[model samples]
Target: MDKPDLTRITTLLLDADGTLFPSEEPAFGASAAVTQAFADRFGLTGDFSAEHLRRTTTGKNFRTTAQDLLSRRGISVDSAELEMWVAREKEEVTSHLGEVLLPHPGVLAALRTLNRRYRLAVVSSSALTRLAACFTASGLDHLLPPADRFSAEDSLPVPTSKPDPAIYQSALARLGIEPQQAVALEDSATGVESAVSAGITTVGMVQFVPPGERGDRTAQLEQAGAVWVTESWDRLARDLADSTVVVRT
Candidate 1:
């Protein structure tokens, strides 16, 4: 990939779950419970522990994760049943996030600095309700407008999730900006693939990741096409502000 032209960038597309805030522990805790319930209902076998779910489906929405997991087990449910489970998971996770979510360290300071220079929008694989809850809980709702938050699970006509690139494409179109005109901050390979596949320059954020896991996660994000990986929002903010580009292999 070529170096991104920072001068041409006009928008910052942010991923919500781990990138913008540290909600994975609580969010995945709720998700694992809901997923286990779904698995029990369908008689599907495999671990649905919180860590396992986070490892397997960190960047995927509940709807996609449910279908994928069930399909792997050769279990299929009717649309009504699937919708019911999806709704339940969304409600449980959103509620959990609303109560426990907080912005990643330095996220507020970074956003306060960057928001003034570029258009800020959330581009996430989460449902809009969940994203809304996250923003409100983390005190980020004031920085990014509701209309600017794009959810792959709720914003599109046919709900989808990352690594599909549909959400990033939709977000770019809605913002009326070319792919090169925006920089995407992601924390997972699935999200990096989505943004990169849509032709946007992607950066990986791993501040919320465990220290021991960050090296592996950083490599995964780079392999998925992130131009850079960072563990500090302040560093990212400074780099962007100074128009410094650092590509890590």
Candidate 2:
């Protein structure tokens, strides 16, 4: 990949779930039961366990994951039923996250520094309500208010999930900037792919990942087109500071 043009970057697009906080376990854990119930109702087979759900659908909204699973089984739900399940899953997941979510260590300070010079926005595959719940629970709602948050599941005319560039494209359009003028922070392969496909340079943030698994996750993000991988938000903040300063000089 070519080097990222840090000097030109005026916006920072952040992925919320694993990037800003550790919501994957609680969020996916809450989703597993709902997913299994849906599967049982439709006779869809294979794993819908929490671990499997996290692994397969970390960067996707529950609605998209459910639809994909059903489509694979040649089963399609009408809009009403689909919307019902989506709302149920979202309610469960958001409630669970509200009780357990916490911002990653150093993230608040890192974002404080990053915000001074960059326009920061959250772009995610989650529904807007779920995203708001997470941000609110983690005390990050103030940093990214409703207007600065873009959701693939709620912000678009038709819902989509990551690995689809729609959300990133939408954020760029809303911000009135070219893709090159933004940098994306993502923690999942799908998230990285989404940003990269939108022509934004991506950095992988893996601090929330388990220590033993970070290396693998880093490689996964790199293969998905991340230009850089950082283990912590503090490090990323420092690097961006240095790079932007160097460019200015």
Candidate 3:
């Protein structure tokens, strides 16, 4: 992979779910709960595992992911019903917020260090409420406050989710930076696609990916256009510091 031209990146846009907040367990659990609820409601007999949830729903918006889940069970529903199911899933996930969400190791420190030199923002497919829950849980709420946060909820009347570039474009417009002047950190192929499509140099984060699947995951992110793939925030922090030196000289 080519070295990223970090010198031009004055702002950083981060993906929350797998990148900043690593508590994917609860997210998966919530999806499972909602899927099961639908299954029970429809009298379907198959089970949904966390792995299945992670694989299918990780980078998608709630509506899209939920629709995918329902489709897997040979069921189909209209927008209103899908929205209702999504609401239930959000409620179920919110109830277990504390147990399912936490910051990744070294992430807080990296954020603190990076915040000193670059503007930081969160761009997520997650709803604003759930994003707030994770940010509050991880104590990242203060660092990337509301003004600097953009969620699916903010992507109104446009392409409303990741892999669409609308959210990233909105964030860039708000931050007053060009896409070439920013770097995006993301953990899923879906997010990588979104960032890359938005014209930002993107780094694929793999710290939260299971050890056995990381290699394949790395390949996936690369295929989706991540310029770099890393498993350690500490290492990324150091690289950023080094990049600053290059920028100065």
TM-score per prediction, in order, is 0.95, 0.96, 0.89
**Which lDDT tens digits does candidate 3 get at residues 1-249?**
777667777887989887887667678866787787776776666556777778866787667766565677788777777678878877677667755666654889988888888888899987777777888888887788988889864455542678878888888887788888888998899999999998999998998888898999999999999888988788778878887532311
Cα lDDT tens digits for candidate 1, 1-249: 454568778888999898888888788999999999898988888989999999888899899999998888788789999999999999999999998876554889899888878888999989888988889988888898799999999899999999999999999999898997889999999999999999999999998888899999999999999988988899888878777432311
Clashing pairs in 3: none
lDDT score for candidate 1 against the true structure = 0.89
For model 2, the superposed segments whose C-alpha errors exceed 4 Å read: 1-3, 245-249
Report clash pairs, candidate 2. none
Across 1-249, the per-residue lDDT of candidate 2 in tens digits comes to 555668888888999998899989888899999999999989988989999888878898888898899888888789999999999999999999998987655999999888888888999999998998899888898789999999999999999999999999999999898998889999999999999999999999998887888888989999999998998999999889877532211
As for model 3, its CA RMSD to the true structure in angstroms is 2.8
Steric clash count of candidate 2: 0
Best by TM-score: 2
Rank by TM-score, highest first.
2, 1, 3
Clashing pairs in 1: none
Q: Identify the candidate with maximal lDDT.
A: 2
